[model samples]
Target: MAQRDYAMSGADARRAVETGLAAAEWYHTDIPRKEMKALMARADQPAIRDTGLLFGCMALFAGLGIALWPSWGSAPFWLAYGVLYGSAMDSRWHECGHGTAFRTRWMNDWLYQIASFCMVRNPVQWRWSHARHHTDTIIVGRDPEIQAMRPPALGRIALNFLGLLDAWQGWTKMLRNAAGRLDPDEADYVPEHEAPRLIRVARIWVAIYAATIALALATSSLLPLMVIGLPRLYGAWHHVMTGLLQHAGLADNVTDHRLNTRTVYMNPVSRFIYWNMNYHIEHHMFPMVPFHALPRLHDRIRADLPAPSPSILAAYREVLPILWRQLRNEEHFLTRALPPTARPYRAELHRHAPGVPAE
Candidate 1:
């Protein structure tokens, strides 16, 4: 189907359900390696420049300046780090996830491991989970990254602690996946060849962490390990907040492709800094396109998308009505968007539950 045609029928909630369910069954029951290979290849393009790197570095420098400059010492360095330096780091990792950090694949992996180590994130776990997110956007029981539960204790524990814990949990998840504890279908994005590299990169990350701590203890009087080191955790929290706010509660229910992700209004500055990731829907549809190309793709397809929720601000407001509900109970947010053909549809009854109404 044309991307445009996909967008139209895709706007109907029921159409989304049918389409996603069908695709999931096909992909899961009889994996179409050839077709998938072809599909993924079609979207593959050369690595693009990361314009965000300079800005990210600047943000990091600015935050550090605020923290260390004598006159600026009490300037709430963590806040500056969170809103600015943190998102800057996110942009870096975001590009790394796409394998766009450098020309060689190995080079890119190393860059991500080093940069991610400094940022206190695990590139291997992030790459795996993020790739899975692309493969299964918003498909409940499928997308491990999707905000699956309400009262978000899981998200809170996993995501809130400056992504250190989130990254840590991701590593733990990766270990289980490697051990064959997780279903192959649910394994997300690990590949046989990538395993060795991930293990090595993980070891490098451990060494970097230890060296950083040891250096902090030996060199600085202020316990640089605790003070400066904690900023990366602050950065992780910023990542979690912005990331969750961007996509968490947009849909009435999880379905697939179109309804699962939403676009937000972004100012030019943000567009430049965030590298156009705010065009969430288009990126989901065209996952292989690098961050730099997203704006062009979005422009080409703008008229085809469901009208954007009035503005990013308005869109955020729209999610609020459901946020507390989601926080109160998972069921409230666990519904799926339905396909047009399936309307006259009843709320999806959980196969596991009998005589129970869908929330």
Candidate 2:
């Protein structure tokens, strides 16, 4: 297996375009236009109810944690708060960024901004970055959000559980953007017109973080920092665990979502926190469908998708080994075994030439 470059400026990106993999037409399950329209319809009720639960829980946990500070009782409350703030916010940011989480445009933007702050992601930059992700998902040189690149950085992935690497990179990028410097990869996806807005948002984020730090110092307590800054590091594991199953060892540079994306059935609590993003293949196939409607969408397209992993544990069982194998054999990938009812994979149309393997 050759060492394949995953950087946006690398040869793979140029190859993806030349090979017609970048922004190429992808496979979609056939559905009646009227039925699809109904599924894609945005509604306020579901988003409203879910948002209420999320904020309500965060308030409850934060209040309890604050009141019980310096006591063991506060530990559980803070733990709960961290997961909601750090982990759940990832999904919220994702769905809201798509502007499909709520029927109301302002509602989506409001939550998107809040969640982006919680996750330490620049909303303006990620909006464009994610658009590229959807346009060229898992394409080696195109998608900016490829979570685990091959000959996988095992150490970095481990540190990311504590949000160490991601926080460092995110804060560094934020500061750079605040300094009016956009990285080449970012400039590649984000429009020139959006650069000013991105810088402004980054500056605002830096100011808020500075304020939180000052408050912590003024009080001679860690409370403010714990509340605003630290949870992203402490509570990131759940999202990282689930997020890794998405495309960790899947084929890259491929046009088919089924080849690179995964759908794992998770428990009810996980579903709520992940905003139903567990139905990842369904979400990728029809991004316009709201998170609340993913299960219904999954049912509609079940016969056309690979058999979903029965649980998160099941997904990891399959994914972990593939990742380990890829450490030595970068060309190796788990070709999802689609069900008999599913559409056959177009192997010939794969980005790699016939008899040549894709990285």
Candidate 3:
């Protein structure tokens, strides 16, 4: 295949539509209506409990960090706080934005707002952005959210662990939005009507960050920022680790999620912090399912799915080589084998997957 064009308004965008890949109907595993209905059912209790735990830990850790500041003794507490703030909030922003975390709309909206702020994402822009992500996942030139674009920027991915590159981009985008201009890529997916709201939120975020920086300057200490902004940098590792595995090294421009996603079993703590998103395939297939119900959903649907990686490390073992290979081939990607119980991939679409090697 020609070198991939990942830009939404580029030649590949036209090619994606011409090839019938953009907004194409995707394959889904079969499930009984009753069972699927139950799986999709929403509730408040689980999200309420999880949100409480998430923020509760943040409070406890931040409290201890503050109480023991200016000492190495406080480092662990701040580290823990950073993961919760930096990593945990990413999942919270995702689930709440999907409106699957809570049955109550207001609760989802409230948490989405808070989590979006923590993520340095514009709630209005990201809501639309994520909607487009679901609509055209991994379709090169169509999916604005494809993380590991062809000839992936290996260095940028490395810097993301420290939130440096992403923070710079995020801050720049926030400022641009605050100045009432949507970046070209952002405008491709974000609605013009929503621009005002996104701009307003960006202004609000600028005010908050400015105040936090002023407080840091006034006190001549990094403590204020530790509570407000620095965690997004220092504590971003876990989320970056989990988030990359969602589609990294997997097939792009394919309709079958089986070819494009991974589901890795993770430790309870990582699963909790990542909100069970390690069930990546299932989440993509059933975006309406609440995070609490994902394990059950996985059990219900696993027979038709490819086997999940036994652990996060196992997934890394599987993904790292593919990514390394892709750096050389650019078009190289992993092709997951579905179990015999699974329905065959949609033949017409799978037959034409660009750059995918023959099985």
How many steric clashes between backbone atoms does each model show?
11, 0, 0
Give all candidates' CA lDDT scores: 0.51, 0.89, 0.89
Q: 2 or 3: which has the higher lDDT?
A: 2
Positional deviation of residue 221's Cα in model 3 after best superposition, in angstroms: 0.6
Residue-wise lDDT of candidate 1 within 1-359, one digit each (tens)? 11111221233323544545423421111215654343334222333334344446556755575457544463465455444444555666676677744445775555565456555445665677677567656544434565433434554645555656655555554455444354343333566666666566656655555676787768754344433345556656545544654556544233333444676667765655465678777667666555656666666555545445556567656665566665554444323344343322223422211111224
Put down candidate 3 lDDT per residue, 1-359, tens digits, no spaces.
67888888999899889988888888898888999999999999999999999989999999999999989999999999999998999999999999999999999999999988887888998898898888888888888888788788888899999899887788889999999899888998887888999999999999999999999999999999999888999999999999999999888878878878889999999999999999999999999899999999999989988889998889888888777777888877777777998887666655555464423
Which segments of candidate 2 are over 4 A away from where they belong? 351-359
Locate the minimum summed-lDDT window of 10 residues in model 3.
Answer: 350-359
Please give each candidate's TM-score. 0.65, 0.97, 0.97
TM-score of 3: 0.97
List the candidate 3 regions with Cα displacement exceeding 4 Å: 356-359
Cα lDDT of candidate 1 equals 0.51
Give the alpha carbon lDDT tens digit for every residue of 189-214 in model 2.
88999999999999999999999999
